[model samples]
Target: MKIYFDYKVQDYLADESFRRWVLDGGFRNQDSAWSQWLLQNPDYAGEAMKARDIVLATQLTEEPFEEGYFDTIRRETMGAIQVKRRFVRPLWWQAAAAVVLVSGLLGWLVFYQAPSPETEVATQENVPAENVPFFQKNTSSAILPVALPDGSSVLLHPHSELSYHYGPAGTREVQLTGKAFFEVLKDPASPFLVYSGEMVTKVLGTSFTVTAYATDADFSVVVKTGKVAVSAPKEKNEATPGNADNQTTIHLVSNEQLFFNREKAHFKRREINQRDMLQYVPATHYAYAFEDTPVAEVFRQIGKAYGLDIDMEESLFSGCELTTNLTDEPLFEKLSIVCSAVGPGTSFVVEEGRIKVLSKGCNQ
Candidate 1:
């Protein structure tokens, strides 16, 4: 009768009150009591919903055994018991012994089911028979490298755990409980997916970093190379077979990042700063100075250096030129100087980590 707020999905399934609430559609007073409790504890809603789905999926609609099955079981069990004892008891005692044997046999029959040949073959084909669950916990002082079965690698941070199954499949999936950097091997056919709490990060063959801990208030995914798709997990009813279209998905290219607010369920996209890139791309011999440089080329260099995308009206800046001796200023400072040099009415706006250039043509 006492249900803790921290109970997991399995715990909810095992609770008699919880089962009654779910099976009866929460109509009774007892059901309403549990429902009110869930409303008061919003954090438990997700687990309760999952447990409800499991119960519904596995609910028995009818008796498993066919007609006359129990009669046959009763007869067989009584014969076995009589043969084992090999002694004649009183008629009443013999009948009572048979009833006890039948009850025990019925209990076993209810809990166990022998799969048919077709069912066994179907299970082997659909389920991952060859793949076994693999788990790695990084408790070391330094970052640990985990080699996956698909030739991809993950650099797990300290206090983090990563789990996945290994098999020859077209899709690779992993679950993470903390921060980790992934370098996935190229397999266009088999996309790699990482599940972290409410969000799911997916990629074909890319390098990325994910920070998502149960204790953290926010979750983040940063793409270092290639493309990644981040989205919330689809509800059970919304997940269609063989359909990959995710309406909530946000596609990210290299140098982009997605931040998810756990409480609000909001997603904010941003570009990675240049200072953060220093660790990935070492300082090269490239110069930041531009002397009558084409506007397109200037923007290209800045985008490449900082891992950003600069959106501009190419026709407007077709013949435009920029002349400035840019230093190691912040990214926005450099953009301010560029916009000012372009024209008097020229301006730029930053939204969703991409810079949008607005200008009234240099010729005007």
Candidate 2:
């Protein structure tokens, strides 16, 4: 998932997903990310709403694709090695976006990188040449999707770099120069090794993010699912005083993160559950079902699960009860369904980075 918090009005207007969500009334399904984003980053809501309005208004009116549109955008993008962050309005987004869609270049927003000047992207049919080392860089403003030779995958953050090599015994080794999220295919026979300048992360089958910039003094690893073992040089481990364990490797599980200071050679691990925000939080992470449960209580569980602060008058919904299985629905749809069960004149809204439940009264 791309970083939604960093997006401005123009960014949202330029995004096909956001535009599709707005125009298709698709807030109830996987497109609920927009609602979740609005709830998490309220500061961007006004701009998002404005962009939403523009999409609904101008995008609805079908516009013709002007010639030279593709070449113009590609030329502009290729010239800038470092795409500067911009906070501006989209002047002619509708027509240009339609052109990109019609031409089947929807992936123009993101491009893969190679060591040389050219862009290299691997597909199911066209895999990267084996035994030939190649570099993948995220030169665009969005995260770049990387498909490794193995079933393993990676989400390379913007400006990050990665290169992989096959080792003996079928082991997989990759060197990372910046932040990136990795989801390795489970292969007990072949262990995956990520070499971050300061430390190395090894995993049999896991999902995690490594942030270790060459110029930065601090490095970190956060595990999302499965296990990760981080190990540094013996000198770096033994340098820190008072570490009686003399352990050079630190193992981390899900929701746990490890931080290392390159200067001090000190390692600190912290549990990150409340504030660790990602652009996409799968609804299936937690199964939510109700058996004649109070509406207020249900909302509270959802709020805590999603790390959302829900503002509601508990007393107002005290009399309302709901019983249903909501294991597979997106968050906003769950809320809408619950509101309907609680009776009329009741609903929810995203306000100021929180969810506010509006109710006239509970069902009598």
Candidate 3:
């Protein structure tokens, strides 16, 4: 674990144990050494995720990358002269084919690094300082995609209303009167919060669905990925011991759901079945599947459905195809599966609030 203290995204991607944990495809890497290290140093999670994408994209190829092959690729990217090479390992030649796009993949995947503790997200960038406000009502027949000030995203259901503002305190807050699905960007400094009548759902970053209708007696929150905390008024909702504020907060992680009664100010938490998650969200938006679909078309469909921009070099996947049900899995997992299906030397990374696919393309 101490050895990984200085590991960057590229360093982690080049490691075998790190690749093994990512290839395992399980969210909880409880038994992995790196996982234990991460538990001790949580700040490196962003870097870990960036490296995971590179691992998963090129993971299908069992051949090991040449020692410091990426350093060579970086030199090549900078137009370094071709020097006489010595073989440190086998299969480096085959992987070099991916260098064409690895440069872009590396630079674009810097992602959202954790800001210094002293500096916080204003969310009111290029706007009035008076808590830049945005109110959106999805009056259309289809789901509406709304971008928030804090780089978070919302998939508002039809007829749902969303109003949010980021004040001087730096907290990104939203008030919802109806149902909506939120895909929050991870920001530890500033908490992202959603208020629905008497219930409040808070998260540092995660994806979740909240159905809080004013007409209905109950409001529910379903976490799609990551964790969230729900604070609601209970009949005897006294403050917990050591809590300065008189609030009863319920913590929920993946596979957990919360149902809060607005009338009685009571709430119930339960473990949710993955298959039934669609019922909690708008089916038209959450329910999507592709069968025998070309990889390019699949990327476009996912981009359109989730209201995200997926920049891909279509020519690469000309011969690639996929077939799967895109349900329950978080957005990142969906991309991982697609890259794995296209064979090896393929991967995707998030950058500038969108997705970019990097690959060596497919063999004819």
Candidate 4:
């Protein structure tokens, strides 16, 4: 059977949650990895297949593709890489060894390592679910500001999907993919369960963003308020009636982030700042007024919304800093403001769904 994934899902494959899902008993080894990668990278089937072919052809003596070509290819097809720690080592020794190994590999393995043979992801067909009527089901592309039965507000991403059933059950459960931001209404008795990629996040009530785009290179859960418990699929190996895959759970507090990468087969948690949180949050209905916001961020936002390419030659504006308010301007006006920041000679153009920043003057 064959399943198709788009770019959004491909990008999320590097998520820790996705990795956990793959390693969990949910899918057979190859199928699981393939499923995870396909889910995160729907738009990248051809490239993914090519990478998988190369990985399977491991030990081939063909010189690696040109560094730039391979770099670009890796950027488009790569997922996170994680090395399993050796438990026999003492904590301090393990930490030191990890530092040394990671420093040596640096971005090579983390972002661009060649995929292993076993890591090749295969496409699959959905195991059809019976009894769900077509009429009652919502369309996939529907973008709605949904109020969960428990009162939480969710801004669903374009083309992402959610499925839920509500009743007297003690907790509410929902399956999600793509991206969404939740402003959950508190309900301690009815903990909220969000199934994304391979990980499940349980929360009582809080604000958080769950990004599991099938094309994204990573799966990320960022908590902006309250707490969350992140864990692998319920254990199929648990000896007791109640115990399912019960792996260790990572508790995340506000400002904490969790990532699950399927190819890496692990989960990671990190501390994040406000700036990190703001990037994933959906654009506000109104523009933000900035006083001393970094110019780089401004350029970034414009580039994203307008599909503009930024070729910044100088580090000057990256940290040069700025003080400005953008509350009332249109997007183009905002672009104009940023263009003005880097002196008069620089210019910006919007063409064919892309914005290109050209230099009449600045240089590195």
RMSD of 3: 19.8
| Regions of model 2 farther than 4 Å from truth | 1-130, 235-247, 277-364
Pairs of residues clashing in candidate 3 = 57-346
Query: Residue 2, candidate 3: how far off, in angstroms?
Result: 26
Error of 2 at 124 (Å): 9.9
Question: How well does candidate 4 match the true structure in TM-score terms?
Answer: 0.37
* Tens-digit lDDT track of model 3 for 1-108: 456768899988878778878888643756567677787778877798889877767745478875666874574334212111211223643354244223222222
The TM-score that candidate 1 achieves is 0.39
Per-residue lDDT of model 4, residues 243-361, tens digit only: 55455578887678888775554678999876776766544333444556776666776545423355455455665555554432234334544555444454454323234555454
lDDT digits (tens) for residues 300-333 of candidate 2: 8876654555789898977677775553223454
lDDT (C-alpha, whole model) for all candidates: 0.66, 0.65, 0.67, 0.53
**For model 1, what is the alpha-carbon lDDT of residue 247?**
32
Clashing pairs in 2: none
Report how far residue 48 has shifted in candidate 3, in Å.
Answer: 45
The number of clashing residue pairs in each candidate reads: 0, 0, 1, 50
Ranking 1 against 4 by TM-score, winner: 1
Error of 4 at 318 (Å): 44
Off by over 4 Å in 1: 1-129, 166-169, 233-247, 277-364
